[model samples]
Target: MRAVIGIGNPGRNYIGTRHNVGFYILDSFAHKNKLDFLPTKSDFWKAESVIDTFRFLLIKPTTYVNNSGLVINELIDNFNLTMNDLLVIYDDVNLDIGNIRIRKNGSDGGHNGIKSIIYHLQSDSFPRIRVGVGKQKDDESLANYVLSKFNKDEINLIDQKIPLLEQLMIEFIANGYEKMLDYFSKESNTNSSNLS
Candidate 1:
């Protein structure tokens, strides 16, 4: 089985914040699939779904983003999942808004959430989707910027891209990261050709 963990703070106050994009994407995907997240006895809520013959779980950590690894570690053990069976989705301030980058494995790149997960898991061998939420201004504190809501235009841009993000996740569920990366590469080339 595979699992996709969406990292974010839990609660109403974080709903529209850039730091909550991971939760937003998972929520959208669950809603579209008619899956409802149910609270577990642990530190997360999960929606289970099957795509083709693949069974996967969509997880939202109930803990704050900085402590996300604790929840992920628990789930990994409970489900008997390996690093290859997990896919993490979270926001990246380094990329421009509306962009997303996928990777099989890597360092945290300064994300506390990823850093925590790495520290707990003791390896960077999982797949991840980094959704762009735009960089913080030089004058602003990174925490304040990430915890803030997006402007109307920024929100709309992300909304438009959510469908594609959902589809990309479906690909991850049905295949491993290699095939998913292939699909993304083809899609990117096609999109680039159309713009040229």
Candidate 2:
């Protein structure tokens, strides 16, 4: 089974924060697909369903962002899932808003949650979708900036992008990273026009 893990801090206080974009995307995907996420004994909100030929488990790790790997590794072991069968979704500040970057394997690039995942899994061979949260101004504290909710304009952009990201995710699961990259890269280029 393929595992799609969305990383974010778990709490009502974190809802709508930039850092919770991962959870938002996954939730949107589940909603669009008519999948219900139920609380699991493993300390995660999970939804299991098959799309096309892919059998998938959608997971929102409840261990919070910093300790996300604990839940992810447990699920991986329990399900006997290979590294390649895993896909992590999380927010990245390095890219512009509404942009997504998919990488087959790489370092966390300063994302604490991803760092923890790599540390616990002892491998970086998994695929990942990095949703852009946009960079903050130089004077802003990183933590505060990430935890802050998006402004109205940003929210409008994100609202438009989430469904497109979901569609790209479906293609990623159905095809692979190369096809997804080709698709999203072109999509990003047309984002402005599409949003208009």
TM-score for each candidate, following the candidate numbering: 0.96, 0.90
For candidate 2, give the lDDT of residue 144. Answer: 90
Checking candidate 1 for backbone clashes, the offending pairs are: none
Candidate closest to the true structure, highest lDDT: 1
Query: What ranges in model 1 sit over 4 Å off?
Result: 193-196
lDDT of each: 0.89, 0.84
User: Which segments of model 2 are wrong by more than 4 Å?
Assistant: 185-196
lDDT of 1 by residue, 75-191 (tens): 878998888889899999988898878888899999999999999999988899998999998999999999999999999978888877888888888988888888788877878
After superposition on all CA atoms, what RMSD does each candidate show versus the true structure? 2.0, 2.5
User: TM-score: which candidate is best?
Assistant: 1
